[model samples]
Target chain A: MTDTVLATQAVREESPPRRGGGRNPLRHALLIALGVVMIYPLLWMLSSSVKPTEIIFRDPSLWPSSFDLGNYVEGWTALGAPFHQYLLNSAIIAVGCIVGNLLSCSLAAYAFARLEFRGRKLMFAAMLVTIMLPIHVLIVPQYVLFSQLDWINTFLPLIVPKFLATDAFFIFLMVQFIRTLPIELDEAARIDGCGHFRIYWRIIMPLCTPALATTAVFTFIWSWNDFFSQLIFLTDQDLYTVPVALRSFVDGQGATSWGPLFAMSIVGLAPIFGFFLAGQRYLTQGIATTGIK
Target chain B: MTEPDRSAPPGGALSLASPPTAPAPAAEAPPAARRRRGRRSQRAVRDGRVAYLFLAPWIVGMVVVTIWPIAASLYLSFTDYSLLRAPRWVGLDNFAEMLGDERLVSALGVTFTYVVVSVPLQLALALALAMLLDRGVRGLPFYRSVYYLPSLLAGSVSIAILWRQMFGTDGLFNDFLALFGVQGIGWVSHPDFALGTLVVLNVWTFGAPMVIFLAGLRQIPVMYYEAATVDGAGRWARFRHITIPLLTPIIFFNLVLQTIGAFQTFTQAFVVSGGTGGPSDATLFYTLYLYERGFGSFDMGYASALAWLLLVIVAALTGLNFLLAKRWVFYGD
Candidate 1:
């Protein structure tokens, strides 16, 4: 499975073809082609967004002969509310979710990781089991509960559960991260008369920037892309988030604006893709480190 | 309330690494230290209070959001509770009704087929791609990130909508098929192929399990392969002997997770089929059907019953996987 000899032979045979290159060029070319195919839809969407609406499906080529910038301009104002309003709405939810998850999940993780508490092991197991609890199981009653609170068509329903640490995945992620940190720090903090909360705030929190950032980035992206919960909770158009607003472009009663839909889709992906690029290192490292262990 | 004997060593998610060998024996304990040690019982009590204080949000959420909803749904499954009216007790009538409901049965059939087909294919693709990357390739990180991009977009509405467009009659895929002199039907619309397109879509996002497999691949010591090669093992021989057994744990994890995830697929089918699970219910995923019953037709009782049924199925399948795992999943002691 290691292919050690093949690697060594490739290094020897391919080195003269190109200095510092040991991998087979054919394999590189093949993988590059496959990568392009993997990302083709994204490229197709980008190209289609600039093509004339009438000719979008008519012309299947990725490169358009003529550029029509109307899609971005029209899609922005196409829906009843301008695109920025939806962006702002999504931003609010994303930020709220990140803050909620970071504070509550880290607090819970600290308790699970460091503090010796009653029923700690059982509580931890309960949380882990709930990780597999299907969201479908909760939707009806949650919807009913929110409706009874008169929170239908409101951001509160979409955002409040996040604040209460409803996502156990992040809690588990943080617990894994905290476990990797040495326990002696907490012991030393205690020797200096720092209470559990103080050690958590002053010591563990400072050392947990990477894990917290992972939690924040993931929460932001997940909330930003969340469609079902937002679709169900926010019925009014004016309060629509990005995903909800984007859905409206397709779900319009009349002709669908394929051009604008693609255009807005690209626009919607910008921030998330940007965040992913910025946080890619931590994201990959975090998953690679914790997922195996 | 007591210290709970930390000397016994903690367990669960936190203690993947064994608890630190009971603190090195104290060589220079004084009376002042002994007095402080006597206060350790008080400290455990204090930690308990502090732990609950920190855990208040999760505790409250588990009750109100999770436990209550699960309990209520279990009850509502047995009672007719439309939003406008109080629930009327019906006992096992909903489950009995399920026996006769063709759509519910078809939905289960659809869901089962999806799980059975998608999980293995996805895992195989993931393992294949992971092996490709594991070959010590150049620029592997870039390749990994690009490949992983799709998994990140897996459940996004935009991607589903894009998939719908790409599989439409005049879409990119059909156009590409025309180049091959093959006539292609509307993939997302044709009853025969709508589920197939969803299956392909599910398989296409194999990056997640691929990554997990890569991580697992890294865990296998290279020395084993060196030893195998020294014994005259070839590529296939080494893979069969050294890789498969060691990687089974990760494979099992991916299998269980992906199976559960495939069973709950909603947004893609919902978006592709325009939230109706249409084209004669060919694309009617289980969750989509549940949504249709619960919110669409307001058959809350039936939907609640379906929800419980799904939970039971998932639990049983997961339990089954665990039981079977003992036979196949190799843990290096």
Candidate 2:
């Protein structure tokens, strides 16, 4: 079955030369130019973050005339809430989301993949339909619900539902991954007098490390970058995430300090870049697998 | 969670009929042990109750958290519920008010226009890039990752901040325009160009669809192209006859997904317009309007109504696309 699937994929790989018939050198140059255009803004931001405030707008090029690392220190201290506290809040929320998503999603995925139950197909379909539901529809009601429970301004709004499998997309992804594993291992564990929970904890979880890693990376990035929910739920400046705190750099009176804002922006995005680099291998594999399916 | 018995009444008959295939070890085992095993299997089937036990939290969560909130929002849309007071039964008053509300009408208009214009342009750009990367080019993976980097950072607040700098007065975009002997209009500051800047931002994140398109492009059979080439078809002709037809389904998929996404856009406009949807509310997208009503003004009832309207609009558009796709989206059956 696997070979057949691979063969079909191979057959599908053989198209798309008609539009790529231009001169190779010109095409390569154009592609590189496009990449540079796309990447230059980021490079500019990184360079400007280190430049002194007076020279930021003065230099229009990709590189700064001189590097002044004081911008980082100044920006960090000048933020309304200490940058470190916001960073800590972001880290806690992100890590909590990751842990909650993995445990709840993997358990649900395993059950959906391996167990037989009534209404399984209907329940699965309902889960998929939720993906189509626009999130804006849920915000007000969710806010009201959280407020009634007195969970406002607390991490409960962000981290609690994840532990209960609130997001079904990750669970579906885990289900698809778990379904590809062989069933014989489960049967063998059963014959040895093990139960379903034991099989899940001892055998299934260990084997699905790659999927779990992918889930963790994605959940971390998403929760870290989440601004809308953070903006709504956290009113206190001390409770802000990095993204929320960064917005305060732009004065509502139309005066934005480009140097300090960009500096803080770079600092904010550093962890995401670090995380992506650290998990590059697993991320690519996960993208290739989940995307194709 | 239940296991099927392999040596009960039906199993015994099957075992007797297929005795040759039945394991000799099972036959040598005492009848009492075999019966015990059968009973154990039956018990496993009957008492496989832990499956639901494992799923209990998620089930309760779906009910209390997701389902209840959705139902509450649906009911709230028909009432007048400002955050300050108890909800009053207004009975379609919010919807009626929305119809006559000029700001809401224009927000929907602006949102529809953004979705209609951006989705196709983005997909076309993505497909073109995907085709360029599919030529077995060296450093293919690196280029793919570079292109995909924008998507990873696309929706973040930092990118929105970066967008303001790029399109603001005296920004890089205007500086580039200067070299071409053309003056830059206020891209993000002027009401006329504010929405255009947003469209550009939406177009910039074509990387995700481009990756999907690359995967889809790889799936096409090379023999079909060879056959077309042998028939003396030129590059353009081959593309017209073969590539375009095969790529329709993916295009349709991207179109639907991107449309749904674009209609719900909030952050870029919120950040660019300074969270006020200003420059005469030209950049007031649907969700941003919803945010203004629900959060900024605390008009929960009206916002709920608008939210339901957006859900309907998205679902209707997606449904319409699928219905039309029957005619255009070719399957490889």
Top lDDT: which candidate number? 1
Q: Evaluate model 1: give its TM-score.
A: 0.90
Error of 1 at B24 (Å): 24
Q: Which stretches of candidate 1 lie over 4 Å from their true place?
A: A1-22, A253-256, A289-293, B1-40
lDDT of 2 by residue, B67-145 (tens): 9888899999998888678999999899889879999977987898899888788888989998788755766667777
Model 2 regions lying over 4 Å from their true place: A1-23, A285-293, B1-48
**Each candidate's lDDT (Cα)?**
0.80, 0.77
Q: Candidate 1 on A78-118: residue-level lDDT in tens?
A: 98989999999999989988889999899999989887655
lDDT of 1 at B32: 81
The docking category that best describes candidate 2 is: acceptable
The numbered model that scores best in DockQ is 2
Clashes of each: 0, 4
